[model samples]
Target: MTSRVPRRLYLTIVAGALIMSVAMGIRQSFGLVLGPGAVEWGLSLSTLALAIALHNLVWGLAQPVAGAMADRYGATPVVLVGAIALAAGLALTALLPGLWAAMLGTGVLVGIGLSCTTFGTVLTAVGRAASPERRTAMMGLASAIGSIGSATVVPLSQFMIEADGVATAVTNLAMAMLVAAPLAFAFLATDREATQAPATLTRQLSLGEALKEAAGHRGYILLTLGFFTCGFQLAFFAVHFPSYLVTCHLPVSVGAAALAVYGASNTFGSWFCGQLGTWYRPQYVLAWIYIVRGLAIVALVFLPKTELVALGFAGVLGLLGLGTVPLTSGLIARIFGTGNLGMLFGLCFLNHQIGSFMGAWAGGWLFERTGSFDPIWLATAAAGGIAALLHFPIRDEPVARPALA
Candidate 1:
């Protein structure tokens, strides 16, 4: 089955996967700096959390614009701009002093960068490159391969932090983004070809029409709402889990190990979920992923905190990690078609980023006020349950489109 795929399609998939790997890998590892960053800057947890929250919010706000541009032009230019922004953001965060730099660099700049380079842009390119039958599977493959960034980068960042300091680790991350920037060119030919192909829509809808159609879609609304929990849960874990583990008096290595395990497990989880979407209802699979994830979080929070237990918890999360991306993106493609996929998916992702902002900020706020993460943990678990319910009744069938007049 794999051998039948065109070499050009394969190249697009590989390129997309590598872009995601570098972008997401570095983003996920940001938590490793929380402790040192706070100490070095003499900043409160809430202050740093606000910066991260801003990052999520900014990313959410910008995603629609980025996606629209990708839809209008091509992903190559957007991705190149994103790479430069990411590198610049990291460099600013590392070199500059005080809270403003953190806010502008890690918050606004990195967020803008991520909006262009991550899932919405990259996945849309890959989805457009494949036939509808193979789209979801290829997305899964790209996600699975992309998971390599998190697995490797998280551990490497941890090592760098331990050896040199937060500044050095972050500077190296910037360099890595610069090195990977060339991969953006890979999308040039593929995206142009995909863009020229006949759209699946009965006729091309203006951007306004597309938005109106999506607005009226009950399933799209439900899916968008459910996606909030995904961002909330993931952002919270990515930014705070390391600190949480440290709060429990575990060795720093344990936190790093657990995240590394998460990245590793996510590779399999993403691919498996992607493949599962092809066989079963993607919405239903997404519901189960959330349910299982909620249960895992509950277990980890309440259970004994041993190295083994932590690692095991991380593994469960890893399996459920970004698995949601393929399922959600694939579902949108199914409902609306891939012509406006980037923009539509970006709209859904906006809600996800809003959730991310809340989770990241609330985790720190609650922790600072109550001196415990218990409340937030329970909140996240409940949010997942709510999301699971939202996803269950989604009508995944394609929407009715008016014929071209």
Candidate 2:
């Protein structure tokens, strides 16, 4: 069974990871365009920041709907639609040249696209395909591979932007998304029986009941709240960190390289965290990630701004970066079972997106007002500390349900 599992699921896993790579990789590179695009498009930094912020907001808002659809139908259709939306959003953002177009293309459409393609939808499909025992480890493997996006795409984006221009670079990225669209079909390889196994508690519960159960569970609530910090910290950095480097007089290459390093480091961190979940309680792992993140931010804030320091900071952050994802999703699966994993993880992700919206928007808004990112940096650190506290007390055991009548 173990040997057969890899052969059977390899395509699905690769497809999921590739799709995630394109979605997240392109998403991470948005910061690279901010400085150049702002100048070329004649927009304030705050306006572009709003577009990114709106993207995150729309993504969060649409995630639950997307996840539910994936749960009810399948991941293929949802992912295919997401791929088209992602391509169209990128194309529109490239072709059109106005604020409304930017908002509609990058903010609304891309956000919707991301909701369908990213962790909640994709990982759930992957998780549902794996055996119960192997699920988390498989997810970790996929996530680690998915980190390839940041490592490769960010630098590619930077190169394209420099060689051609912002519009051309974005248009090319759109083409890449279209090229990757077919991979969504691989989701059909998933074993439907595994997902609907009779042993799962959530198999007997309605969506509404599952939501209620999660709402009543203290661990779920804590997990959701802690997730908010993850969003805030990550979004803040992804959107503003490049611009922040410029303010410090660091070259543009430093920003791209830093992001790339973060992505590379994320590969190992995600896999390591996922493996740790198999042996340790996921909640404790999550808590330490947050605590370490907080300290890292504090250190970065106080440290002198140099290319080396920025790169090192990105490496540390990357290590803790998307690691939260596998751990968080795995925790939900552990507590609730894989039956409603998509919807449950989506609900938690909503809170995370809310934090993302705040982080992205607030970073730009605060910087515009104060001409410094220090306040936001401090705030993000504080949020991490709070999230660590919240995760420490979470009960990571599976939910107990009465037998169905």
Candidate 3:
């Protein structure tokens, strides 16, 4: 029998992907802003790094709460509220630019917004919307589409900054969020329980029980540990890589292009990995992604600093980047079932955020102290190797599938 996604669920996935794109696109541009923002204030790079680091940390801390909210009340309110907060945060940051303001706006508000819109909430919504057979592929496709925002929006932000100003660019993007706000209701209508009988008829397990079980699961624990490296590496690069390139006397355009390639390549690669999730062991896929990342960084460290090499490496990195999300999340659905998928994934992603915190903060702190990014690069490469090893022991058997309705 051929597997198929219902039309309404397909629309739901599209809406979720749209929200993710907006969230990721805006988040990725934080690094781009650093180079120019430094020119504006002459502030230490560490300050910007702190704000971005705080963003990741806050996003991590809030994800579980966001996921729980989605589980209980439906994801629509959570996402709608997030979009409003994001737009407000951006507009306010433009009007009043400072360390504290950036922290409150980008760090706290945008961070909360990110938690609601990105993977945990959105992907869960998609998972619940899809049939078991089609869910994995849909997960990959959603991830791919959402990632495109990064490619398109990062450069768009760069252009706006060059032509108008950073303030103007940010404010305009804030205005754009208003257009996407209506899509949230789609998730509410096709909610996790929409296709099911009354909640009471389903097998009963309190949210507390779910949490306790996941906390104790060996595979889940290992999965969370491995994800830490992803958070660390991506956040560090997102906020610091552009500045790192500029310090090397490369043109800013190379940095922009690298991010663009990252977003673009990740779109295809994530989908490919998502499809792989159904056909192969997800743990193996996750392991390979980390291994590739580690080897790529090592190679880059030893190579010449030519723009050709930098952009080429970036394109390759982008291809490998973000393939983990579907694999990891698919693993979650496979191993534990999707009953508490949002909350469980949220917990795992919390580790990712913690890693993001370390990555962003370490990049700034290390660079400021040492005046070079070498130490952090070495650490990231090592972390990648360690993470690759961590995933190997996860038992890959499919468990009882959750009623995703």
Candidate 4:
């Protein structure tokens, strides 16, 4: 089955990557608006935090269903629905004044949209389309390129919020998201169609059996547990880091600038990890990334807060921001086979999203209670250490091809 990928498939992957870039990039910038949005809307940080927290939880909860649907039906329809929902959610958040309304808009609609557009559906489509030998590398390229949106959009969003206000900024993002509606057509039905053929190895395992096999594996459990740290750490910073900097007496520009830096830096990390995953055992690479992230957090917590230091911290975070994704998702493809990659990877991401809820909500809750971020920082550091240990024991061997055939 090993063969050269056609030019059209490469174009499809690029379009898919851009689709993810727009979806995830805009979501990452929510933190840029949270502080201003709370002030403008007469809402408390904790209330807004809870909204984002709920968003993560909902995204996780919906991912498996979305993935399963993609596996059964196809990705195009799923993506089309997501693009519409995301646009509508943004429009609602921009127009509505009520907190609960905003929650439904930002928290619920965007969350479900994310489930369909992001890794669960898009990456799975690409994974199944690719040869097994090229799957991880393609995932890496797509995921890494997705970081570009964050790099450009974060600073741009901040600028738009400053010039036009929060509502207009969000509305602009909403309009931009509609681009995905057209891009959704790029995911041809052929790959998913090929899998449905009776004689193919991809057709052997039912969704239920695929899930059962993964659940029974010890390595899968460890991988799931370890992924919690990725969510926890990212969500904490994504939601609270700017405010945390504000508390440090830094200018708001510094916060936005730092996010831009983080986004820019992550591009390299994402690319490197993608390339590294092709050659190395992804588990080891994943392990080192966690350990290094933990150490970086230690430095950020202990070091004095200055504009330069703040930017440096963001740089470190950016470098590690999405670096783990390729390794983790690639590992899932290797272990479980690609037939049910969407649903299986969705389950893994669900764990990450669970941690995401706690991270975003807890930062606000704890800051409200204690009036400081020290505890949140400390907890993230410890979680990183824990994740580093979890990957060590993962059974990295691929499942037997004959078993499915």
Candidate 5:
């Protein structure tokens, strides 16, 4: 006889997926704002890039605390707060003209918003409710749905920015959060028995102590290292690909399509990778994913610089790009029990943002200083290779329960 999935599990995953898509779609569209904002404000690339960098940096640093809070309290409030922040940030961006206001709205506010509502919190809720056998698939489902927002929004933003003013585009996008906010009710509507169950945050491990545990654990180390490369590649391309296309004498629309392609493929890739994680050693699978990404980067760097080559590589890389999400989070769940999964996973996400910071800043820095992105692409390839090697040495084992203050 086949076992039926619980209603709570089904409800949580579907709601989490819908909410994450809308929030992520808004966050990812920030790239579309860079050019228009720079043109309107006469800002240098570095100024805006710095804001984006800070955005990622804040998002990364805030995650552990957010996860801890979600663990300590519940993810529902955090998710609700994030939805509100997202809408507020975007609306403020549309009304404000000053860079500081924009930074506060886009960088600081939106970053914190995403930290609360995103995969970090949503996946934590999903992981807690899911059976071990179902965890990877659920993670994949979240990743996929989140990317679906990207797939849908990027082109829409491009069209909106072109048709309406950027300000209007942002206003409408902020309003789009209206659709995402109600879903939080579903997140809150959990079975009391499940929510009342004790979580790892009852006596959360101090950051220093968690660091010590993660440092000693090979699997955690590998996961963190591999995730760094992911941030580097993702941030770099997401920020620079449009400008790079313009440099190569291609239309900006090509860049939008490329990102959308990555978004579309990621929807599927995340799901399939999730299934793969269930059947294989997620660490091994992650290692191979990084290796493949490195090789793809190398090939793209050497390929003839043309619009076709750029878009093709973008789509291919996009498929391989987010495929690692399910594997990374799934492996963490496999080795570290779900008690503090949000905090531990949030720490890993911190590494991702650090890489994102470098990626966002480095792309602009290299271009302004050297007038080319060739060097940045080369470095990304090298980073991917190193990250691939880093994963091989990780040892996946559960942490020992120690009584500590």
Candidate 6:
């Protein structure tokens, strides 16, 4: 049954979506910049890899804190700050000296910016605005929109790289971030409805207590382990896919098309995850997704390098790739309630980013060292299988409340 949607809720979802897309687009554009930046700065692949590693690390670590802030305050000011930081980071990357400064601007600065603005922050706001019944669907819609940013920006970035130059492309990306600021302003124009439910309260759990709680939660532990694999796989490909294509005796166009296909498929995947979750238990669905991903990766590794074949693999994988997001986030809301979701999910995301760091850095290091991506592909396939296994035993029900004293 379709839930009645509110106009303000719709606008808020759209605004949060745009913020995520713009923030993510600017970060994803790093692929287009890597080649040019390296050539201009005489930097090695490892250096660029380090910057991206740091970026993923910071982005992952900062998310829980950002979520906490947004939960306590509103999403507006935090997202606004992220938008400005994204612009500044890109601008600095365009004009910065030396590789170290580049890492600071592009990696640390941009990563933190995205941590504040991307899926977690926006999802929290959208979740808050929508009714309980509509929350998952709204989250899916927002994610689908954000996926468009990934899809559009890669090719657009490649085009800009060709038309003007990488430096100009970076500058243009900085300008693009400003667009989100206005969108944020529009979203914040309406006040969110106050929940009639009693405020879910928590006494600050010591880090030890929090960790103990998370550790005992079988699903949460599995989620953390499984999501690490997702980060590893995503980072491995996002940073190295273009270079890997070049290794396959194909044109760079193939790489760009592969990424583009992944982004496009991701939109469908994200949306589908939302729609499907309404009927199915999210944990079961996510487990199946991971299993399918393992199979897809195995197939892609053996698939021919023709443009059609490669793009097909990319599209199929893309569908499963980011689609995990909505399910993962939804599971958090289902099990932990959105009250402390920011912190809980932030901890979960830290696991994902740790994987991201390894994936991004290891892909480059291995390629530079081994001169082939074959081993990494095998690792990705294995990781997917492992993630599937991890989720198989996750308890989907909410934790029992503490008995009153």
Once fitted onto the true fold, the runs of candidate 1 whose alpha carbons sit more than 4 angstroms away are 1-5, 197-201
RMSD in Å for all candidates? 1.8, 1.6, 2.7, 1.9, 2.9, 2.9
Kindly report which residue stretches of model 4 are placed more than 4 angstroms away from their true locations once superposed: 1-4, 189-195, 201-203, 401-405
Model 4 lDDT per residue over 1-405, tens place: 234355656776787878888888888888898999998878888898998888898899999899888877778888899988988988898889569867998899989989988878887877777777887887777777878888888988999999999999999998888966678787865445644744654446788788888888999999999999999999999889899999999999998988888888878888788778889888888888888888888888899999999999889888887878777888998888777777888899999999999999999999999999988898998998899899988887877644443
Better of 3 and 6 by TM-score: 3
Per-residue alpha-carbon lDDT of model 1 for 204-311, expressed as tens digits?
A: 777899999999999999999999999999989888888888888898888888888989999999999999999999999999999998998999889988899989
For candidate 2, the 10 contiguous residues with the lowest summed lDDT are 194-203
What is the lDDT of every predicted structure here? 0.89, 0.89, 0.83, 0.85, 0.79, 0.78
- Residue-pair clashes per prediction, in order, are 0, 0, 1, 0, 2, 0
List model 5 lDDT by residue over 168-270, tens digit each. 8888888888667777666664424334654543354555666676778877876886788898888888888888888888888888888888788889888
Superior by TM-score: candidate 2 or candidate 5: 2
> How are the candidates ranked when ordered by lDDT, highest leading?
1, 2, 4, 3, 5, 6
Clashing pairs for model 4 are none
Candidate 2, which segments miss by more than 4 Å at Cα? 1-3, 194-203
| Reference-based TM-score of each model | 0.97, 0.97, 0.94, 0.96, 0.92, 0.92
| Error of model 1, residue 125, in angstroms | 0.5
Clashing pairs in 3: 192-405
Candidate number with the higher lDDT (3 or 4): 4
